[model samples]
Target: MEQQATAPRPRSIAPVDVEQAEAALIEHYPRLVRLGYLVLPPALGRNRRVLTAHALVQRALPRNRVGGAELTVPAPRGTDGVPSEPGYTYVRQRVLRAALDAGRPRGRWQPPRPGQLPPLLPRVWGLRLFPRSGGADELALDQALSSLSGPGRAAYVLRGLELSDDRDVRRVLSAAGVEDPGAALAEADGVRTPAGSRDTPLLESVEFDPCSLQARPTDLMRRRQHTRAALTAAAAAVVCATLLGLPGDGWGRDGAAAPPYAQNAAAEAALDPAKLTQATSSAWKSADRPGFATWPARGDRTGDRELLRRALAAWARPGRAVRVTATPGTPVGPASGPPQLLFAGEVDAAAVVLLHDGVRVVRYAEAKSGEAGAAALDFARTDAADADTSTAIVVGRTDGNVRYLTAPWVTGTAVRDLLAPAAAGQPLHRDAEGVTDATPSPAPSGGCRAWPALRLGSRLVTDLGELVPARLTVGAPGSPRDVAGAQALAGWAHSACHLQSVRSQGVRSVNAWQFATQPLPGGAGSAAWLCTRAETWRGAGSRVQAQFQVPGSRPGAPGAVVARAEDSAACGARDPHVLAGVLWKSKAGAWYALAAGSDDVASITATGGVRGSARGALLAVPARAGAHAELSALTTAGKKLTTLR
Candidate 1:
């Protein structure tokens, strides 16, 4: 993992100084412009809002406040040092908001009108100086710009000419033109010349077009002529197509359809099956390669010589076999039986199938995971010749991401263990497009679920299994402490017990011997129980369980060593079976839960139990050691329900 760098300290500089602000801005202006341009379209280009935003922010400098002492806004910082627009993010956000607001419809605000600007016309160029030059088009553009209204011209210059946003364009128009140009200009980026001026055509600011004359001018005069012709042709074509109803360029002169353009012949062939098969086969057999054929079964060595010759010619090169064998799986398409294929070694998850035709083929198998490994991808097993006919191939998910494994044939084990989980109750089918392994909409019957129980001690236990006295109780009768209440035995069969989550009937707390069947080791059987000093407590309250003894010595009782169960109490409630560890919540809203394993649970057990139990009885304390217990107190108001000790 990459380590994060420590943040730098704020630069000590006077924020109010406009000079410093400008200098800072100048340093970061390129980046700001690039970011702003990236966010907003260039067709709307640079205008007064951006310029004003730049200036206002620049003047405010160091600190983004009107007066430095009044509101000392901290300067924004970059990697190396302080930024010119210290709070550039804030300023940029504001500018972006304003720019967006300008685009929306409101009572007062309106889109600006579009107009052209004079094209660049150098004095050096004449009409005949360069015969094909676009001088006339340049002149026309200049004339168009000259004729546009002042507001229209300003809008075009700021937005279209400079390639800035509409907000900035509006600002420029306001600054350069009338106080409020208002509706004089609408949608002001490109020049929209009025229709039907037979004698004079306006040019200069043209609409965005990749094939526009501006980009294609070879000579000045030619460019001018071409642009004029294009416009005239477009206008005439529109009228002709709409009113005259002309037949467009429906077909080529020869009336023969031309082949569509393709990037490469091989790619084009791949798109067409007929061409692809022919090309592949011809290319494969034409090379100066040994000949090979499918091995035919020999009876009494009749075709044995022929088969050997075929195999040698097709596979053997110099001395070694070129192709290994035919593919082992059933042929996907129409075939006599399973397709025979020459096997190459496994590459990652894909099984390489080399054929005598020297064609490269790939077959994938869904890989089984969790057998053993550090990384998830390492759980794949590669087999050279998996020719089992009973096992079907288990393909990976779409995009072939998951590891795949293939059984030689269709078998129950292959389907149950490998395919079933990976299939995730998905539909399976083999078609020309390979395999369709889609997740079943409604999951298939017999979906996978958590196993019955985990092996704690020796017995097989279920969630509903009874909790007996042996599982909870510690020592024999009349021992020094008697190991009563709730407590875990240090060493015994009781230590190997675990209780899967079970639904309780009602509020119950007892310190008596109860045989409880629990999860077994290796997650196999359902047999587990504990002796005395072990208690199962539950409730979202403090005062977990009270002790008839003292304040800290062995409180109410010990609890079950839960593995992955969630329980909490505001009082001193600890898990009975602290094997998997215990979790407790304090009245102060502090949480304490042990980490996984025996060591952590041992730590929690050392702390002992609480002196009392909470009101909300979400727990059922089932302890070993014959001792009668009863709920002492119960809360009456709100959702708080605690059991009195």
Candidate 2:
């Protein structure tokens, strides 16, 4: 009996068959792919990594009914509610093993595995696919992961994605062929998760999910050029052979044209400068439509055919040295036909040409000295241009100064500091060509010190570092009026600095509405709640910001941004109603939850961490510092609303 007690029989682990493994892989495809994505090296780039992660997971199924080899499957702990089946465990290990192998460097003599190379099964052409970009925390986490070793990344992914304990991670890593699981675990300990993400691991964020992706075209212009070149080369050979057989001295007349054998009349017509459309001086007043089409060419060089040809050629086929940029949603394609000439002249040291293609305003600039390879082309979408919005266009920008080409209807132009409402507007002189003298532009990176805007006669416009300056208006959403009166200007001064958030967003107009004026709890003077909504030219991606400004703050000081939202109808023409709350500290050092809504709100309520209710649109409740609360409101129309974020 003593001899029989020498050793207890080791538990026999069941094998995972092909059918079982395939079923598990199919059921948990997204989870497995995410795990593989996190473990794969970031140097492969987002697009390739997404493809490779999927490839690894798809190849994880067992080869035959009888399992090829035993896998270390930990007992179910109910951490993620996924059953700890042998099949799932086997496929998970295979995916982990492949991901780690993909990160390893290829040896000169060793044959490369399928996982080590770019995946061929799922391939995309003429497009780049990647996960949507995350915030700074996600970027930091991705960089930290990139610095870890293959095994270390595996350890971290197991702990984060698989919700595994230290023992399970070590076992999984060892099973995945990690030479030193303990060292890998120790290495992973050095990489901490992003701050404020303890409850939700960064591994589960959309940035790391390969299944959900954002797609962008890859070098479309270059692809088109390549295709055109290939077709031209084939056509040129045929033309050359035919000319050599039939004609005498075929290259004599068509010397330069011999190489460019593909001659399309429409393409040539688009590049011709003489074909440019020009409107009459007073066409806008009598025309059926009021837009760029009725805008007469005004610059001094409008009749210069050579300069116009250069601009058209550059727009059609921008060289490698040309710097091209387009606003968010603007098209940068070659001209479809002759575009309307808005302006053409030398402003500063560059020859500038502005063209309108019905939908976008295109600006092309070249060095006046005819510098061989230096040029710039910019495009801004302007689908519908009216008298107010078409008041000004940015003609030139150099150093930290910008010049504007005022509309013919603009009787006078003056520069006003948006942050200084009390200061009188300074007169800005314009030349005979309607180009205004250069003014100090807003320092985009220099913080919110000052915002210089153009006060054109009675209308106000501000440059957002875009081709067209955004029109500034006051009053309610649907029927906004021109920024006028001392009260409107002062209100704008408090919230002008917040405009930086909407820069380069193709904003057509920015309306400031003082939705509510709430008195302080401890008589700390009245505070104003403003809703600034920026409407873009593309009719989408509108930005709304709710700001709270306490009375007697520093002059030109930006208000505290309580809440912000993008592409939301709230605080806009359609909805025109918004609710937001903030934890404010009174002058007496007492903390209180202050909330305000539009006039249309019937009642407002605060819940969680802090609780209060008010029948009107404003609420003030005593609360501790840093209290968290959820805000909901009922409008007069009985519509329920949550606080904007």
Candidate 3:
């Protein structure tokens, strides 16, 4: 009797019909699209990922209807608030399968399936569409996801988006053609969710949502050039066909080419090397403006017509093999007319050319060995660049060293380690072209050991991993002066490491202002609060940080960044005021709410759990550990100011 006993037969999952699948997909369109986006590879870029996500979800409807045969899948368990529905499960599986397929690397012999290729039905032109940027946590999560494999990403998305358990996730991945579902799940475990984010999952952030998107225009001028080129090719083909039909060998003995059609005179002049503008050696002395426009062209190969031609042609239409890059907000369009030639000469193994077109600085470089198709072109926005900001331009960079071309006004060039204030500036020699000797650049990979800054006469400029170095200044926002004095240098030495946050941000200048100093409770010593603001060439995306430097800290130790914000008007020339507060633990092991404000603040106050008001801009109030508080201040001008976020 015991041997005859057996387990009951398992129940079969109901098939999802096309009508039901369509209803479920339309109802949960955004959620499905987001799932697809998270599962897809980040290398496809945001624009393609957005369109592809929508395409995958739209095509998830069942195509087979014979005998009502379609997707047969178990309904969701509804364990994590997701509704349990057979239709939703069917369509979700379809979207997930396509997304995983899209992320796979294409093989040489294997032909791409419909889902593997870029979606053709939802094509976008002239505009790059992507999801809005999220906070630091979301950005970190996205970067972590990018390092995972296709199946691993799928597993993570399934767990986050569907809230499915391991058993359910394995079943789903196996059905989606994943060979090793367990391995994929194990790989996904490597990504650690951000702390204190259980209430708001990073997976649901706007950074991963394709339904809500931001649109930016692509390279409009380049698109127009491509259109013109296509039309020109078509016209040339017609002319050749007509000539071929002509009698008498279809050509004359002169062997002359056909005349050009629909050519732009200004464009032609822009591409002509001879038309490049060259400033006089003494132009800066008498010029109305002291910027790139007044910089003299100084280089040995300035007159090299062949080199100049190659640079100009590459600027106009760079080949596919050429590496072209541009800073944020920098335009890479062809020069409108002869651009100002800043420099053209051999720097190391490559011949380099620098050109300025009023709003942008274009750098073109090519191999000195006359390599036919190898070249590089770079663009950087230099709008509103004045004498202070245009003190130097990076002439050459190789390995970890960088060479700068100083302005004629710069009487002397010196190299100084920004992290070492007491260290004297080392003299940097310049050649006849005003190019300084190669010095160690601030390597991000090297950590905060040392930061090399270029001291051009009385001004200080540091490379922010851009074509143009960002000038360093110190003082009040309304009237900032170049960093020069020992006190200013000492102040900068403590804040130099913070500049890494603003690297490659198209920053024109960074100003550090010592806002307020407060004595710690129980005589733990005084703490200085400084605010550093990075102003960009685009006049947007500016970064502001409020730093707290403890008294008697190590000489080379950087200040602790207490608060930071992006694209904020506070602590800028327009505002010239900032207020921030942080919880501090003194040496006595007592907690205090410390608040500081700029000089303009008439009074400082802390509310909420910790309450205090001080006549001056600095306030310290004893409070329990982990207590929260709100900070506000009244300016001398009778205006209320909140803490800069």
Taking the tens digit of each residue's C-alpha lDDT, what string does model 2 give over 544-577? 9999989997667888999999999988879999
Looking at model 1, residue 161 earns an lDDT score of: 30
Task: Compute the lDDT for candidate 2.
Answer: 0.80
lDDT by residue for model 1 (1-645), tens: 998432222222343444544554566554443222222222222222223223332332434433233222223333233242533433432333333333333454544311111113311232211111122232223224333444554445434333234544444334332344343245233444443323432222222111121111223533555566566666644543464354653211101112123355433332221221112223323434212222111112222222222222222111111112222221212112122332222322232222222121223121121111111110111122112110122233211011112221212210111111111111122232122222111111122121121111221111211111111223322232222122322222222222222212111121222223333223333323322232232222111222111113121122344322223322212322222222333344443332221111111111234222322322223232322333232222222222222
Those runs of model 3 whose alpha carbons end farther than 4 Å from true positions after fitting are: 1-262
CA lDDT of every candidate: 0.26, 0.80, 0.80
Sort every candidate by lDDT, greatest first: 2, 3, 1
Models, CA RMSD each: 31.3, 19.3, 16.0
Better of 1 and 3 by TM-score: 3
> Residue 481: error of model 1 in Å?
42
Please give, for residues 347-455, the per-residue lDDT of candidate 3 as tens digits.
Answer: 8657899999999998888775455534678899998788889999887875345788889899998777777777667667688889876665675443476787888
